[model samples]
Target: MTTTVIAGKYVLGMREGRQALLQDHYVYVDGTRIEAVTRDAPAAGQAVIRYEQGLVMPGFVNLHAHCLRGGLFRGIPDDLEMDPWVPKLVYHILLPLTGIAAKELTPGELHAVTALGMIDLLRGGTTTLVDMWHHGQEMFFDVAKEVGLRTVGAPFIMSASNSRLGEDGNPVWDYGNDGLAQLAKSVALFKARDEGHAGLAQVAIGPHATDTCLPELLRECRRAADDLGCLLTTHFAQTPQELALLRSRYGMSASEYARDTGLLGRNVILAHAGCSTDEDLKVLADTGTHVANCAFGFAREGQNFPYARFARAGVSTGIGTDSHGMDLIGELRVTGLLSKQFFHQAHTGTAHELMRAAT
Candidate 1:
């Protein structure tokens, strides 16, 4: 029963890498679905918004975003380049709130933070985001539903109680029992209650990071995701120090380790694959895996991803802002520039290549 028109000089689709340029155009939206995109109005819509400048395109999608930690832990630098230690440092230094602390909130603060994070993303033209945060996931879901943004709520789950594995390859939680049983139930409840409620919410599972999830836990999570027919995301090969730890513990790369535990495939998305090797890249390409390149954030930490290597390997690379909030456009531009410099080849990662990746 509702209709509108959005006219801009150019319209682009980041996913499809296509742009429709028009001196004068109109887009008619029937309820939520875009009904028609034409140079002239159909004379049926209720509202017509004419944008003089700025590209009108489908909003960007941030594949890996952390809403709760983004706002609560912003501007706190805990020396992230140290690999395995960085995670421990971040968790200990920024011990925000969880378990007992979560119960203390009256639901208002949770809603506020959720709205605040989504508002920032929406303003940046991010229509959809996959968020992994340990606290206030329910409130986050509610806010996304209300705001009409597509959101995937992934609660941080782990099987290692002590946050690190022991020398015997045994996880510290439940003696390898279901350490994330509560988290699993929470995910199921949220899915059952809100999966299709507002056309804005989907349930996903994030295994935190490799250093935090043991082999058994990762396998179990993968099986669970497969059975439920959902998406699975994880942090893999984030730093050299982390890679060293994995090598010491299992004598294998983190990518191989994840694959061994059944965590690599089309449905699985990895973030910050800075430490991946050539063999790891082959596995990723063969598995049809998707990667979110946080090149700019890593650039700040003095770590540059192997963008040329990844592109050569035929891996589908998507751009992500992480928690930097600089917008995808800037990230995309920086990625292209960095790749060109890293490879020392002018034609390696051109602007059009980066634009195609972003789109």
Candidate 2:
């Protein structure tokens, strides 16, 4: 491969010991890896590309996202709150259409929609993302490889039940016994797609959420993650209804249930966590579990994560676009602002801290 040098007027990157905005820096690239970054220009006879006045920085990482859903359902059911919003828009209308799309859409058509989402992420300067969705995950992997983005594909695992609000404004669950099969499918996906992908693609276990997965199923997911040597992630404590249901069913908070099931660990990534109580945050901090804060989606419902408190409690927090149009840049800004509002203090969640979460 030919060597290339890229020069920028300003480079926002790490220098010496901390974050620094460098001036007149040139990056030396050879094939896939960056050879070096320096203030001095490259020696004579090297291919060079110069950005006269641009801020060059590392690409963002979206810690949680749903790519297919983001692409297929961007502007439907726009103005609604969380409670009626989920059942009426998501479970009733969108989810069934997803199933139909899986069966009806051609491979080319499916890949096109999925690729549009990935392209949106890349165009927005996101170089890596962790995506969880149902159906056509293998197609998602193919698109990731083609697009040259580092992706962790997690297939959604929902085994115990599919719960949605009935006409009476209460949950109606349709139970099933497909947990073991889904776990097997997840492991097989990891072995087939993740093992020999040269680190460009990876796989993780995504047990849908506490409300959808039984305790035994979650425990098995933990063991599978350990055995497969990959990350285990799930949706936890995202809504008041979920919290109430978990407490009623298991007699514990969502975080407590996760801890008891051996699901809280260094390798575990919990998405949302908007409803995690103070005690739950302590348990998360104690166990070294990470949280993916998808602020934009929740903020639409007039809610926000306790990200500042989580950061102060020593919990590693990262930014995720979740289902919010794949605008990681916007998510970062919202995360920083929401943290300050949640803590009722300025600079409580500094820009540096939120940037660390995204990258």
Candidate 3:
């Protein structure tokens, strides 16, 4: 056990909305978890690390981020439309980058790239990151552990969707090229070694998106998360095309489809739920489900965020970078601006509300 004192200008805890301003605090750490957080300074015999003009806060939790893609595809502007731009971007940019290939990059190269992303995240004060990548689970997990950050990694799963264009000009298939056994192996590996030195590793079942997954496979993933007592996350209602496809196939909206399929509950997080309707928002509100919106990136691609509907529906909304960039401040700032522009109301998204979403 070790004890230290830090004098900080601001110490914010999201748990109870606790804030300590311009004060000296004592933190007792018995290994990982903080044993105690006190306003009082440590005794005269104790050591102290004081900061000037610095903020000491619990690590930022990034609800949604793709670590590798963010580094590889950053700075390329995306067209608002997804029809041809998405495909072109993938094949022309991402697919050509050998660095992203799990088998292509040597241990050193992979570590370096992963480190690049990790360092940027840490510098920005993000302590927890939920990442989806194209590499092997073990490799990313190992690198994340070495960086001393909390991680939630998911194997990117896809199924039965031939519409999406991969970088190699081929259809992106489901989780495993072999079969269900491969899916089992991925889930097992994540369950086996997700924990690391920082005590911040967690495993979640990640299906790529609703359009890519078959109903049976999605159901299986939901069951697996429940059995493992972990989180189940997927992309849903990201675009109008996806919404139309799900409705046509399932005879209901995407959120409604999830509800009917028994996937609309706690521990399930749907990312980029921009196309959800008013009714769909109500269901999400009642179910205690969470929506992580990448408002900055999605809007950069011309997708409008239905914040008014979501707020009116009483849905608990969180902000994400969605692999574009992990600038929490930028995301929060953009969210506030977008809300005012979208609703034609200057008072739509207040600073306090935006801060709550980002923090």
lDDT of each: 0.69, 0.79, 0.68
Ranking of candidates on TM-score, top first: 2, 3, 1
Query: Can you list the residue pairs that collide in candidate 2?
Result: none
Best by TM-score: 2
Task: Report backbone clashes per prediction.
Answer: 2, 0, 2
Clashes of 2: 0
lDDT for residue 123 in candidate 3, whole number 0-100:
78
RMSD of candidates 1 onward, in order: 4.0, 2.6, 4.0
Per-residue lDDT of model 1, residues 1-359, tens digit only: 76767877766532244443445556677787887667665565445586788677667778777665556555554345454324433344333343333566567876776677788778877788877766345677778878777887777767643354345432234454444674576467555754643467877777877767777778878877787777788788886666877788788887778778877899888887778888888888899998878787777666678466688888877777775553666777778878988989889877667666665
TM-score of each: 0.82, 0.90, 0.84
Better of 1 and 2 by TM-score: 2
Candidate 2 residue runs with Cα over 4 Å from true position: 1-4, 29-35, 81-90, 160-163, 166-173, 196-198
Q: List clashing residue pairs in candidate 3.
A: 150-200, 158-174
Q: Considering lDDT, which of the candidate structures 1 and 2 is the better prediction for this target?
A: 2
| Per-residue alpha-carbon lDDT of candidate 3 for residues 1-359, written as tens digits (9 for 90 to 100) | 67556656665443366333434555555556767667776777787676766777666667788776666567765653455323344334543453245667677877777777777787787777877764353577778878876788877665631234556444355434432443575588666865633456777788767766667778888888888778888887766656776777788888777876556788987886888888888889899888887788767766568455576679878777776776776777788788888888878877666656655
Model 3: CA > 4 A from native: 13-39, 77-100, 135-137, 160-179, 196-198, 306-312, 345-347
Candidate 1 local Cα displacement, residue 252, angstroms: 2.5
Model 1 misplaced regions, further than 4 Å: 1-3, 13-22, 30-36, 44-46, 78-106, 161-178, 194-198, 306-308, 345-352
